[model samples]
Target: MILCADIGGSFIDFAVVHPDGRTEHRRSVPTPLDNAPAFIGALVALCAPWPDMPLHIAIAGVECPDTGIIHAANIPCLQALPLAAHLHRETGRAVRIANDADCFALAEAHFGIAKGHRNVFGVILGTGIGGGFVLDGRIVPGLGGVTGEWGHAPVVIPPPVPLDQEAAETLVPLFRCGCGISGCLDTIAGARALERLHLWAGGTPQTSRAIFEAWQTGDRQAGRTLDIWLSYMGAGLAHVINVTGSTIVPVAGGLSNAHALVDALDEAVRARILTTTSGPLLRRAALGADAGLLGAACLGLDIRAQE
Candidate 1:
């Protein structure tokens, strides 16, 4: 059995995957993000009982994915840490470190929505947005190790031709995003974006979850926020579709739980695209949250195949 793990800001989840791809004995624990060594110590404690067990690590960290330097935003202490190298020394086993989003994309392409597509872009809409592209069955994470950083794309929804001041007033101080930017597409369209609009409409912050709930009930502000998100997302995706010409665009993240949102997103993209040859096949990621470990398993399987 191969021990597979997916580390997130809040939790680190793991399971054993037999050679044929069956999962066994899954578990999760809160992450202590003091630094790479401390985090590694925690992981070591977690794995102490299983020392003799065969383990191959696939990591998603805030580091240079190619160099295995952990420079992730969530795990800022991992910056400049030789994560892969340390894993090899401490565990005496092979380990792989990649951006979490890229791992998710790898999972989608290998066993989920992006399967069979030569060129695919995996879009993740979660606490933050991330995108990753794959070609010829391999993860092609671009330079800056941020191929999946599509969440930070700027949203420029210009005023109508006459530039009405009232309409411009409707677009007041946008959300301050994690990327420290104002009016980011993710900031405007993600869960936080929904909350901002709902609050602006005189809804309480406690009513945040109710915002999505209200979307189901067709609340005006919720619907408008959803619609605006889809519009901005489509505008951003148009650039991706034009540039990469990817065959698949799989929506994989927390937002995927909302079927109506996905439907609206697909419809908006179809309406916005400039191409006639074909619409980019947009799919909700079927792999859900297990993608990190599954894709890590996929990585192990790929390496074994090469050997």
Candidate 2:
């Protein structure tokens, strides 16, 4: 068994996971964002009941593979901390850590929608965009332990010359991204960015949920916003697929709940990619909230395999 925890900005979700992906003793506790000692203590307390099990964490941050230092934007206490080492010392148990996005991909590859696939890319389309690449049932390692950050780099291309005059009106502005880069897909691809795009497209302020609802009901403005959204998002994903040669993509996050939207995006991506497959490459993630814990379990299991 592995003691697994999914550490988010707001909560630390804990569970004991069996090798087959069954989770038990699940619970959650408030995350101590500013106090490092408190953060350590919370995890220690959670692990106390299972004395011998190794602890594995899936966090909303990056851990440098060379230095072991963690950079979590939301959890200030963990910034620059070698979390696994510190936790192992405090709790007297071996510990492993991975980015939540990577963990999500690992879980999907091993036990979720991409179960049979050898190469899988898992995407998160929430408040911000994130992704993880899994090759041969493991999360592919890279410099700074960040392999699948497909959203950060600039990807927006200039809108093609309109075939007709009316098409010119739909061209989106190249907005600056939070990463301090201009024209990144992140500038216009995330949930919040989608709202910004909607406003720029001449629609009144509305939540992403409302926009999807409107689009499904055939709202012209909403449809127009999503048409542009699908075009860019699909193009970005096509680049990822082409480069990775992934046979499957499992999508998670708030936007993916819109089944029709995911279907539309899948169609767009298939149209753009070079390979011709008979079936869709993108599938809705099956693991849901349990992905993190199960993924942490996979991490622990990998460690055990090495030992």
Candidate 3:
């Protein structure tokens, strides 16, 4: 068994996972964000009963492959810390860590919608856009642990044509991202970003669900917001598909619940990509919340394999 933990800003989802990808004793605990000792202690307490098992973590952060230091914006205590090494020492067992998005991709490639695909890109369209790239059944840990971060780069720029006064007032061509970049797909591509786009398109501020519902019902403002979303996301994903040559994209998170929305995105992306295929390339993720723990389990299994 592997003690798997999905550490997020608000909660830590923990489980004991078998080699064959089954999970047991799954539970959730509040995350100690401000205190490093508390955070480590929480994990130690959770895994104490399973002393023989190694711990594997999927975190909402990046771990530098060379230095082992993690840069986590949400969990302040983990910043600049050698998370896996410290956890291994404190817990008295081997430990491995990976970005949560990468873990999502790994899970999808192994057991979910992207199963059997040599190259897969797992996308999370939740509060914000995040992604993971899996190649040849393994997670491709990229430079600075930011390889699948397709959201941060500046891809959406102001149009050359001058906007009408009303359009100019509502539209924001560039919005600063948490990563310090402006005009990124992150500004307009996720749940919160979709709400933002709805407002920008001159609609009342509404939740992503409401906007999506309105769009499906033929609301003009919501329709316009979705149009912009499709264009920007379609173009961005097309570039990623072209560059990575990923055979499949499995989408997860809150937005994936909107089947019609995802289908529209699939159509838009397929129209933009260079490849020609009859089937849909984007598929809904099957693993749901279990993906993190399952992927963390896979991480431990991979470590055992190498030894």
Candidate 4:
């Protein structure tokens, strides 16, 4: 058995992966914030169902790249901490750690829709927008893993929204955002963006799904905001698409659930393409919520086979 984990801002998912590629057991727990030690301690408890050493561990989490220093936004207590080293010492087994978004891309490129594609871009459109690239199964870890901060890419501010508002969006950005850009595509196109748009249009703030519901029903405010959000997101994505020319761009995350918005996003992406007849096709992730854990397993499995 191999212990695989995907640690995100909110929850930590664990799975016992067998040699045959089956998940024998799975567990989930709230992520520990503010105290790395406490978080690791809780992790130890979660591992009780699986033995140590005999079963190797693999991990992926959201963190700072250069040092593998975990940022506290999701796991607050883990900020500036060395997660890879600590896990290795605790498990007393070979451990591999990558960022959560990177893991998502790897899983998709290796076994999901992106399989066999030479250049693959995996994206997440949830709380924030993120991206990861894989070429022939090797992940490109630019700037030590911050390469996929695509949502922070700038777009021209249009009328109605003032320069100060746009500047503030780019200046402070959302608190605790990894990209550090205020008022970014992540802030405007993600689930939170949908809720805020609802309030801005005089609707009681509701869930992203609700906004999608309105858009589907031809609610004018919802339709306009949704279009704006997709255009911005697509604009940022176009820069990547034009540069990499990746045929397959898998978009995951919370907003991926918005079918109506996703349809509009597809149209928006099509409009921005510069020179590709192949054209990028947007697809939902096949791994679902288990992508993180399964991806982490692939890391450990690959390493164990090497040894």
**Backbone clashes, candidate 2:** 0
lDDT of 1 by residue, 1-307 (tens): 6677788778888888775567888888877677667788766766666776545444555556566677656766576777768866897766666667777778888888888888888887765567877776667866766675666755643444755777666663466777777667777666666677666655667343576777789877677656666777877876777777787888877777777777777777767677754553578887877788877777677777788
Q: Give candidate 3's error at residue 101 in angstroms.
A: 0.7
Which candidate model has the greater TM-score, 1 or 4? Answer: 1
Candidate 1 global lDDT: 0.71
For lDDT, the strongest prediction is 2
TM-score of each: 0.84, 0.94, 0.94, 0.81
After superposition on all CA atoms, what RMSD does each candidate show versus the true structure?
3.4, 2.7, 2.1, 4.4
Q: Please report, in order, the local distance difference test score of every candidate based on alpha carbons.
A: 0.71, 0.92, 0.89, 0.68
How far is 246's C-alpha from truth in model 3 (Å)?
1.6
Off by over 4 Å in 4: 45-66, 156-179, 198-206, 278-280, 304-307
User: Which ranges in model 1 have alpha carbons more than 4 Å from their true place?
Assistant: 45-60, 65-67, 157-167, 170-174, 200-209, 276-280
Candidate 2 lDDT over 183-295, as tens digits, reads: 89998999999999999999999999999999999999999899989998999999999999999999999999999999999999999999998998999999999998888
lDDT score for residue 168 of model 3? 77
Q: In order, how many clashes per candidate?
A: 6, 0, 0, 9
Which residue pairs does candidate 3 place in steric collision?
none
- Candidate 3 whole-model C-alpha lDDT, 0 to 1: 0.89
